[model samples]
Target chain A: MAADQLAPERDTRAVEAGLDALDGGGELLPPRPGPWQVFVRSVLPPVVFMAALVGVWQLAYVAELKPSYALPGPADVWQTFWGTVQDGRAVEAVWVSVSRGGIGFAMSLVIGTLLGLAMWGSRWLRAAVGPIVSGLQSLPSVAWVPAAIIWFQLTDAAIYTVVLLGAVPSIANGLLTGFKQVPPLFDRVGRVLGLSTLGRVRYVLLPAALPGYVGGLRQGWAFAWRSLMAAELITYSPSLGLGLGQLLSIGRDLSSMSLVITSIALILLVGVAIELLLFAPLERRVLRTRGLTTDR
Target chain B: MTQVREQAPTRNTVAPPPAPAAVRVDGVTQVFERGRPPVLEGVDLTVAAGEFVCLLGASGCGKSTLLNLVAGLATPTAGRVEVSAERPALMFQEPALLPWLTARGNVELALKARGVARGARRTEAERLLELVNLGSHGAKRVHELSGGMRQRVALARALAQDSSVLLMDEPFAALDAITRDVLHEELTRVWTEQQLSVVFVTHNVREAVRLGQRVVLMSSRPGRIVREWQVDIPHPRAIESPAVGALASEITAELHREISRHGR
Candidate 1:
């Protein structure tokens, strides 16, 4: 009886030791970075970089590198930025641009996903259209504005057309690249599990291709925003309201360099804000959850 | 090594009788490329229900290819491979668990594929996780688990397939010794409890002998079954036990002889 009892204890110990060894060596559970640590690492450096950039801009202004009328100092631009905001023009302009960009990006996402799946499904289609899609990515968003204006008559439809043309190819290519990169082992495993082709695409292929898909989404957003701005600047209608691009156009027409600089600053700020707020965090989470991110 | 002539080929020509087969591979040939030689040629084997069979051979023996054939991932160029169940669940050398999924989610996927309802999947997945001694770590991601734990989760996922046959391709080869030993014990207990017919592929002689009721040895180039040894050791066999050691050495000697045939 005692020997049997002792044997069970010994087996438990052996199992415990084995489990401990399993938990050893390549234990990649690095301590999660604290919020304060994240703030220092991610937020501080960019703030410092921006500060240095402003200092350089101020230095160039102080040195009188250009006439004040032609090139505004940081203070003049800052003053104009505040005036624009105080008059509520900045908020309206931001809302107009952001809403338009959001709608255009959503449309691009749907269309691109369909196109990508089609390309991935057939070698013939991929060969025929894959290069064309990639080529569209190299064609600047600004380049689509003239054709969009001709196609849709300088309305919001024209702006959306430009955004779609600029963004869809990028999103499609992202999905294609992601699909291509999915490990063959996953497909084998999926097959063993008896998942259907559609099921495999939904559960295995899409999740596996997320990093590239998200990368495409980020690029697509950038394209949509750029194309919207280009369209707004070139093809203005009273019904479109005061978009950021319209603000920039107005500043140029007024010949107030400070206003132009202020609008540019606001545009830059919005771009950075969207990336930091939406895409960067999304990409980081995707990578982190997959354990693809290392401390280095 | 003892030259026991009668016990050498323990298959049709020597062993008393064959049991009800859970898996049957008859004259199966696998050709990867048309111009090159076949990976496996004229291989014949049968695994009985509730029996643990180990396929042992040197590297490039097409042992993995044979498992893939049985898994239905690869179709043989000639002959037939049959499993008693719908399909056998395969465990690769690597865990091959979806990295994005938690341990429970990975197991749940198999159950889901098996058409388990959403409401019952959680409980079923939990039960499978408990079977592999990973009940507490079910929420952990694949990368969070240790290598051994990952394999255990994989075993649980395989279990979730609810298939009678389980094909493991050197599942514990990547693990440390202590972990491998523990896994061996766990596997034996689970195999007995679940009454599964397992075809475990490994290069380790001791692992084959320790775990298998029958060890099938294969030769390298154009892999073919060369010999078989029937191990009559009782259940709950320890890796370090004398019986296991003796059988392992015998099989190792046979394996080395098979390897030597290729060296020329």
Candidate 2:
């Protein structure tokens, strides 16, 4: 026991020395990249891919692989794309489709969140709709277009119906999975704090499940975009305005490949732009603050 | 902080006022899993208001289970735990502070749960932090602080609950030797200043001897309270003092004998 007494005193002195020797531990944080480095990292890879795509097109053209109308050069596609943009036709078409997608997406967001939370309330509810919601996610958004036409018939309501059907399941499933993944430790802490059921959900469960819920929102947007395109192509009237989907359909009807390519490019650009400008930054901030995933 | 368990009947009464115990656990038995033997069997203990009692035990001695039963986090299979306080604030060996919240925010949560007014929560939380010597570290994230600093923040959060009793389950066990020593002093100071009754749990004999006014030892596997000592040493006792060392050795020998019985 005397020996044990001396040992802890000596251990205490060693621990004190160790404490004095320790640094501030700032080295654990990753260094911030400079502006020039960030710009290069973001811009260079995409530029290289675009260049490679153009090179492949040019090579096919010079070799006379199929007629000029069959595989038009990148320059021809750009010309038609530039023409549409300069005349404000592309911009108008974008506004029409994006507004439709945006409205549908907002509705789905509310509906999906409510449905997901309802699923969390009981195992029976989860067992009933859980598999069905997941199954809906795998079904193509375009597959709903015919039924939507029969139900709403060439109206803006029909397009919205298809868009909602496409996006709602993804958002709902994301929230369901997110809630399921909340750590049991948080439940113990919640009970200790004497939080009410609503308080526990608000303060603990919701924020803890945010990463997965946001991931679902991102997927929902993709589905909404695709559904909007499918509905627009199939059910267009002059009253509905010429959306990008209609423009692509018109190009096919008129046998102009350049117009078709231009529409495809605009659709791809919108999807990429939304992901880059909105969801990526939101996900990064959430993951970083929670210490879930580091920026590096 | 003394609670009058009952008021006079508004007339002259001859009965003496009962000195209410902070906590009373009578024949507490805990059976965690069905069809398995109970983890704790027929354990009884009482902690008086403002008294510091250390529960010393071997590894599987169900000491934490006893603390949980007192904290109202778990129920005893047979027997009752009576506490005069509204609810006992519990501190774990790990800091257990929410990582998403700032240090002050963590304390504010306890105050919020206790139904303190929104306008008063911030000031109350800040005062608690100041009591724990973490006034300036309120805005810092959990990971930003050192282990000892985090534990101090946790202590502040526990105090924000405004409970008359505090239950600590090896609260300083994970800290370094020097840090643990500093925390023991800090805890003793805070405990006295606030007049909080505490049931501190630990396996270290020296820690039990140093901090407790009374020490209770338990045996393992369906843990039972085997022995107890009322330590009469005065406050501000040092761990390295000869008196603490002597009592710790005596208790250590008893603990060894208790453990040796399991080998057979």
Candidate 3:
């Protein structure tokens, strides 16, 4: 009876002790991967896949699948690529395309973000422009090249117009998606904290919307690069300078299959390089910080 | 059994207490949309400085709406709500900590919002985290911490605002029973230590009895305070203790009766 009477008194103390045991300095998250692990995960697989693809292409060449002119061997393509590299033509072609893509993408980012903010701020604006933006995202940038050339001529202006049309809607819609996904409770939290209207948008809304915006930027870059290539291919003139797409078109006029293949490979390589060097790291950092990455 | 007592009539225009109250809600009526019934009608509540009150009722009782009104997140449709000077800090059922920020960064954001200098912000955030027994875990991400720990960080962040009162809307309702019980003790300790006027809203009867100095029960359908109980239990009272259980059961019975009335 005495022990029974005392047991109830000890329950709270027992619970406190149990809680202390449970608290054990909290959970330990996995350590971030080192540079070598990053290389194995992100770099190695692509290198292996590309090497195997080239090997299969060489085997098909040995088997004599097509005429040597129509289907050039890997060695012929490599020789063409190497010659262009040695003559500095490759660097100039890549730089022209990259610089155009960079400039066009930057302008798109700014305009798209502003458009998204305007839409978020006003229901009328969102209703008016929202569907048009979605429709633009689905429309191929290649389709806009003819219209752009007619509007702005065969100068860089035509290429840039196509690039802007390709990228802006994707970026704006990305930001809008980000803003929409933000939980309503966050706004209430901001209000209770006495944050000013600008402060709430700056500190709460923008940060909440970042992951979506970054996804938008990545997609925008893809669209701009594709549109830039399409514009270059169709709008080539003597004064317009030789981009990768223009180099490929020149190869077509001269009937050099290997040169065309080399130019196409270079264009693909540059797109992959920009995505790997710039956007991949940025996207990883954003997702990791937000605990949206599964590795955490 | 402690029988339910009749609510005192609304006493607006009465002389103020010698010590100023932290919150004053006078005949608050909230209608979210036109031509619909009000969410809260003529609901009046007052919290004195350094007091702990729990608003207890079934779902749709406007307890959360009432807390939002007190927190100034939403304005009452008719009645005036007055907070004695400083803006009250509010906590939601979810932690609401920014996922981009670490637990410490979340607290620092609040300090920054309050215009705390950059030089002192870090140490002050640490001190607040320390107050919640999460000093060493401040560097962890929001996802890294356990559910109970996240709520503690939230409490720390709310404390960072340096508000006179804290409004909590079912903050611990999502946690497991054991964790909730542990948090109850942690909350009571912090409540006394901070000397904050707290208006805690919850549906749990025992939770109300465990932490509140006064438990106010509200009836739903244009929510109004129907009865109030002053918990005379001493400090550090266990949730399983007879005193808490007795008051909790009595309140639970009344709550059941109140809830049953809606079925008919």
Candidate 4:
């Protein structure tokens, strides 16, 4: 139809300015808490919870509910914990276990990502190996400790074997889940944009799958830590050296309740510290970039 | 308005089409699978260069299927679908912006796909964003944008492909009425400015009237073009204008007749 060309009722730039103002949130991003505020919010709650736990332990001791050998006083456990720290045994044990976990998890990450890509690329491989991978995740890594000890002779190899078994399945399955979550629309968008097959995977498919993949990595780390603890506790040869789990095992043999309690606490601390320092931040960043985080 | 199958229904039907054809679909029968009725059977539609055509239909009419054909996202089982230039840009019912990218980043990806050098992409992306009246909001992530803004960005992204034709599948169908109305004006302005051929698919009668130069009605159950109407009303046409309403009701009556057939 012969109509005069678009005559803007108002100046378009002015209109755009108004529209842009309204398009953004009235408050935009909520102000993040300052470092002090963050400390209070996060650190305070856990500190209070731990204090209450210690208070309960003190009450149990005051009541003399169990023999002193069976249930050590909270103060006695604390003193053992500090003694382990001062003697440098704590640092050495932490270093040995953490290094093993880190190396084992890295190998699993590479192998698991390749396996996932292969599974994605070929439907036959997916059909053949998909169910087994998922089943492996439910199978506790500790179950393999005896087998690994027999195969690798109760050394670092055995500990690493257990860690890899525990983590690889979760990492592989995480990649698959991420791939599945990518919408078919993305491929079509890729096609319409004239992206090649590799380009499609690199740009659209990979980014879409990232949130799920990070979730898998988080779960994998948890499994690796648990499995490493199980392996060290069970298959401690002289060659395997001292680790937090070996301390826990030694404490059990010696019948020192405070040492056993201290070892368990250190193990728990390592697990939590890794999560807080590494995986939590990584997962948060991935989800935040995709706007998948619910906290706006 | 005429229903002649022999020739394209242009404003001056007596004269041969003035512009070169942008798209030509000849007797395309798209049967997705064997042993099933075809979704689009013998559907022939032509879009001339720089023309704005709206395809009106009921659900299951293969409207989207046909657009997919023109987009080269699909192949016709029995006939030919041709586009004169490079692959046409396509817009979805949803904005389909990648959530991980900023609005400008999405457009830049399209530019990169077109083989625009890495050096020129940033400025080119900004220019396209400005075209859609979103120059200031290029850095905003997809989720940060509102529904209307997302679609506008989508339009900009489509333009980044630099395609001569644009195939839109109900691009405004998901918007609220007020937002939809505003988008009609924006689309009209963009269409006239770009002088690009658009194959717009929609079921909204007034939307077809307010935007398209020729509104082509289609039938379901093996989709076919049933009728065509040439809107004489001039551009900058208001959605609520009386002329748009008058023609819209006429098309609505025909659409109602088509829908009532499904009841049986």
TM-score of chain A of each: 0.90, 0.91, 0.90, 0.94
lDDT of 3 at B109: 89
Best by TM-score: 4
My TM-score estimates for the predictions, one after another, are 0.91, 0.87, 0.92, 0.95
| DockQ-derived CAPRI band for the predicted complex in model 2 | incorrect
Q: Mind giving the per-residue lDDT tens digits that candidate 1 earns over B64-132? A: 999988998888999899999898989999999998898899999999998999999999999998888
Q: Roughly what TM-score does model 2 have, to 2 decimal places?
A: 0.87
Docking class for model 4 is: acceptable
Q: Given candidate 2, what's the lDDT at residue A282?
A: 89
TM-score comparison, 3 vs 4, better candidate:
4
Question: Which of the predicted structures, 2 or 4, would earn the higher TM-score when compared with the native?
Answer: 4
Report the poorest 10 consecutive residues by lDDT, candidate 4 chain B. B1-10
Score each candidate by Cα lDDT.
0.86, 0.84, 0.86, 0.88
Clashing pairs in 4: none
Return model 3's CA RMSD, one decimal. 4.3
Model-by-model DockQ, in order: 0.41, 0.17, 0.36, 0.46
Best by lDDT: 4
Tens digits of per-residue lDDT for model 4, A1-296: 44434433544445545665776542256678788988898899999999999999999998999999999999899899899999998998999989989999999899889988899889999999999999999999999988998898878888999999999999999999999999898889999999999899999999999988998899999999999999999987778889989999988999999999999999999999999899888888887777776542
* Candidate 3 lDDT tens digits, B1-264: 122345423312233345678888888889988998778888778888888899999999999999988887777889899997478998989999998999999999899899999999999999999887778778888877778788889999999999979999999999888888778877888898888889999999988988987889998886888888777677667788777787788889989999999999
- Candidate 3 chain B — worst ten consecutive residues by lDDT sum? B7-16
| Shift of residue A264 alpha carbon in model 4, Å | 1.2
True contacts kept of each: 0.38, 0.11, 0.37, 0.48
**Candidate 2 clashing pairs, residues 3+ apart or interchain:** none
Model 3 residue A34 distance off true place after TM-score fit, in angstroms:
5.8
Model 4 global lDDT (CA atoms, 0 to 1)? 0.88
Highest DockQ scorer: 4
